[model samples]
Target: MSAPSDAKHPPPLEHAASWYAASANAAPARPALSADVSCDVCVVGAGFTGLSSALHLAEKGLDVVVLEAARVGYGASGRNGGQIVNSYSRDMDVIEDKYGAETARALGDMAFEGNRIIRERIASYDIECDLRERNLFAACNARQLQGLKAHQALWRRYGHDQLELLEGKAYRREIGSDRYTGALVDHSGGHLHPLNLVLGEAAAFESLGGKIFEHSPVVSLVHGQTVTVKTADGRVHADRVVMAGNAYMSGVMPALEGKSMPCGTQIIATEPLGEDLARTLLPNDIAVEDCNYLLDYYRLTRDNRLIYGGGVNYGNAGPANIEAVIRPKMLKTFPQLKDVRVDYAWSGNFLMTLNRLPQFGVINDNVYYAQGYSGHGVTCTHLAGRLISEVMTGRDERFDAFAGLPHLPFPGGRLLRVPLSAMGAWYYETRDKLGI
Candidate 1:
């Protein structure tokens, strides 16, 4: 199948105009690729996966170079919900059911590793990204509450004990909203300023002697004993190549085209709600995501703005007005915010695999890739980076565990995958509405 058209997936030159961009810390723009270069490893994409992989590899004293099509964190890494959600989009129990006990055990051990890595990076590197330490999975009804209870138990079996179940008035104490029937709090899972965190990681990688080049999109890649990656004006010949570009990869490699579909999700940031109101909206300042299949995830920014996100476009065409798409959902969670003004609105895409599990493997024994985090990327991407680094360094057990998981292409291939996904999502949304 042909790759998605350039008109539909244009090259990104800068960060999206969002609250994160406005509050981003200043950094010098590194020059793009102007001459041929050779490195021990060539990484494509500068988001969480690429930066983390580069940092790990550089710390091991390997020569590494990262090429970004746009600015650092230019893709979903900078435009995500910022929630440090632990584990895969599909729960561990589901993984165990489908893949068996041993597979689930291996994945479960690394489930919370990403969260730990994030915290370690923040403290060790002094990344000031407004890190918080609480995330709540809110249930819309009693049935969903039961699911959360089962979820807590399942996670506990996996050695995750930092969880608390709350209901009735107790739930209101954590979240001031009455829309949720109950909540499962995971103290280990939290939120952060995603863009700043990624930028800080990039800086850390550079400090470890890594090289990064922005506006150096990979035009073509030839895999062999030594992979060659070409751009408009320059090329990279490396012992290994890592494709970390998720949805924004834009068909740089035809092999990954049908493996995942680019789906757009949007977020809106409300104007400062004042300290008193902000505290009332989120009493403990915990991040939240509902139990619905097509869920809403939100959290309060350090500056007291409500960063609410929801709604997905499987067709990859973003809504004309992001505010219009997200504002109502925000108001539904907090009707008192009817008069609050929206300060920023933006959309970004995430690569969605048919099974909603991340895909990791090596191609031609020299080119490696990790993508399709589904919607749980904030944490999983970090885990992916660590795993990829391990594989590159010859410690391949953990990486092989994940790489062995089966990933199927979306039904109907590239042409009809989007509409098929939309139809499936609509069916689940209906089930969510009926509380089925």
Candidate 2:
């Protein structure tokens, strides 16, 4: 009824949806799991990765079933800044350094393919998700602009030559903001109504007769020749199980707990400004992100509201005053919007591996798990799902290329890792401020 209901009460994920949710044209919720069920495959966590995996496996005619703790898109998939930027948060050279040149090339291909999958799915499903294909990487100053220039070479070397440099008159004409000294027009990356896309894919999976169980959280996992997933209401005994629980994963897989840590990122959406004013504030309607490591990303919705996202906390508890803490940051970038009121603010945790690389691997052979998207989950999840299904079906080369990358646990362990990581963040924040 009110603007902030989705964030203030933070409706139970299964019952609540975000702005994207309000616009979704999806089928009603899948029935809850009521009793023990058997299938050829059981995928845990029904976000984009889980749903995508289920879709591919089902298309192969495998009797696959998906189990979700909350409603679909309850995690980062629904709550992200929605910018589908092309590069992995981790460096491509890291893959080359740890794996090999070919492996790095393959990884780049996967990231590119991930973007393709999003576009192909939208076209095939005829789903309406307010999709857009424009992005701006706004640089705060000359120093940041240099980084973008170097990145341009890296992207070019990988055969991605779509980005354009924007500065001065050109930059202001594009974004209508003087906060950025330069900007990168990200043709390869863009934004979308994330939850709608996730739900739409979930519907596509079911249209093919794949089963989905919502409000059914996986409590424990048994991995082996035959994988078993135990949920609160039922257990799915299957030939294979996939752990797509990106950030909210807990006892379901102890081995993965320390492989990455979750950091809370919060977002607020402004009340719908009329289209005319919204256009004036952001002439291009392109998704905008700054050059800072801890950055602010904002964009306009189809209905003409400002969806602003930034601010991070390693702890699960949100900022003491999310609205108060985040609003100032928004103003620093767009001081002209001092009178703009925040309509809603909600937060979610995103997993970050030590190297900022995504963690994808098998636990006990048949029980596969992939997490640690490091804020690139929107597109990477699609690729993760496709690779998981390929491996399950005996196509190992592509999957193993990614699985071979080493993922070490956080040094201090989960109990102490949060604060340890927070302190590390403080050191970086201090550097970003002093222009180190």
Candidate 3:
């Protein structure tokens, strides 16, 4: 399979105009590929996954070259809610029920590995990404609250003890909102400045002798004893290739197109609400995401701005006015914020698999790919990079565990998958409304 090269294809270049970009730390624009290069490993996509893979491989003294379609973290990695929620989009109970106890156990152990990797990178490299250490899953109705209870019990059985359940006024204390009936807090989970974190990781990778090329989209990938990845003006011949491009890969691999559909999620940042107001809105300053099918996730920025995100477009097209679509949800969650001014609004696409599980596997003998993190890519992507590196280093047990998970394609073909998924989501959304 080859990357798309057409006039309509967006060029791999600048970062999106997001709140993250406005306050991003200084990082020079990397040069695009202009000449052929050879490496032990070639990584496509410089988001969290690619950067993590490159950093890990370079740490092992491997020759690594990463080719990015755009600037580092130009996709969902840079534009997500930045919540470090452990586990997949689907809960462990669902996985256990569908796959079995052993499979669920293996995945459960890996669920928190990504969070550990992120914290280690931040401390080891001293990357300043406003790293925090708490996240809450708020429940709006009794059914959702019951699910949280079951979720906490399930995690406890898996030896996870950092969970704390809050109810009534205690829930209100944790999150300064009257909307939640109860909340489950994960002390191990947290949030960070996602774009800055990715950029810092890229720098760390480069410092370890890993090469990175920005604005170099993979036009074709030729698999063989030594895979060849070609860009518009250059090529990379490597012992192995890793396809880390999620939703933004276009048609790079025709086989991967149907396994997941790109879904658009939008976010809006409110103007600085002052320290007092911010404190009042989020008393503990921890990230929060509801338990609904179409969830609303949010957190307070370092500058005291409310970074609220929700509203998914299953068709992959962004709303005409992102602020308009998100503002109502924010107002519903925190009525006092109705008068707050929106400072920035943006949208990005995440790969949503049919079963809501990430897709990870090898394309051939040496070409590997991992995608379809749903909306949980921030942490899972880091884990993916580690898994890929481990697999390359002759450690395939953990990698195989993820690779064994089944990933089904959408019911309809690519042309109809978007609308079909949208209709399915509507049904679930209706069920959530009915509290069923």
Backbone steric clashes in candidate 3, count: 0
**How many Å off is the CA of 414 in candidate 2?**
1.6
- lDDT by residue for model 2 (1-436), tens: 6312332223234533356656666658666677988999898888888988998888898998998877888888877888777768876766778778998898877767788888888898886778898788888878888888887777788888998997655788767666777888978788898888888898889889888888677777766678778865578999888888888778767767778888898888888888887887788788998888788889999889888888678857778667787788888877777898888777788888887888888866678888898887888888888998899898988888778888888878878888898888888777767666
Q: Candidate 3: what lDDT?
A: 0.90
CA-lDDT, candidates in order: 0.91, 0.80, 0.90
State every prediction's TM-score relative to the real structure: 0.97, 0.94, 0.97
Q: Candidate 3 at residue 400, lDDT?
A: 90
lDDT of 2: 0.80
Tens digit of per-residue lDDT, candidate 3, span 1-436: 6444577355446787889999899998888888999999999999998899999999998999999988899999998898998888887889999999998999998888898999999999889998888999999888999999999998888778899999666888777888888999999999999999999999999888889999888999988999999988899999999999899898779888878888999999999999998988889999999988899999999999999999689856789999989999999889999889999999999999888999989977799999899999988999999999999999999999889998887888888887887887899888888888
Quote model 1's TM-score: 0.97
- Native-structure RMSD, model 3: 2.9
Candidate 3 runs further than 4 Å off = 1-12
**Model 2: colliding residue pairs:** none
* Per-structure clash totals for the candidates: 0, 0, 0
Q: What is the lDDT of candidate 1?
A: 0.91
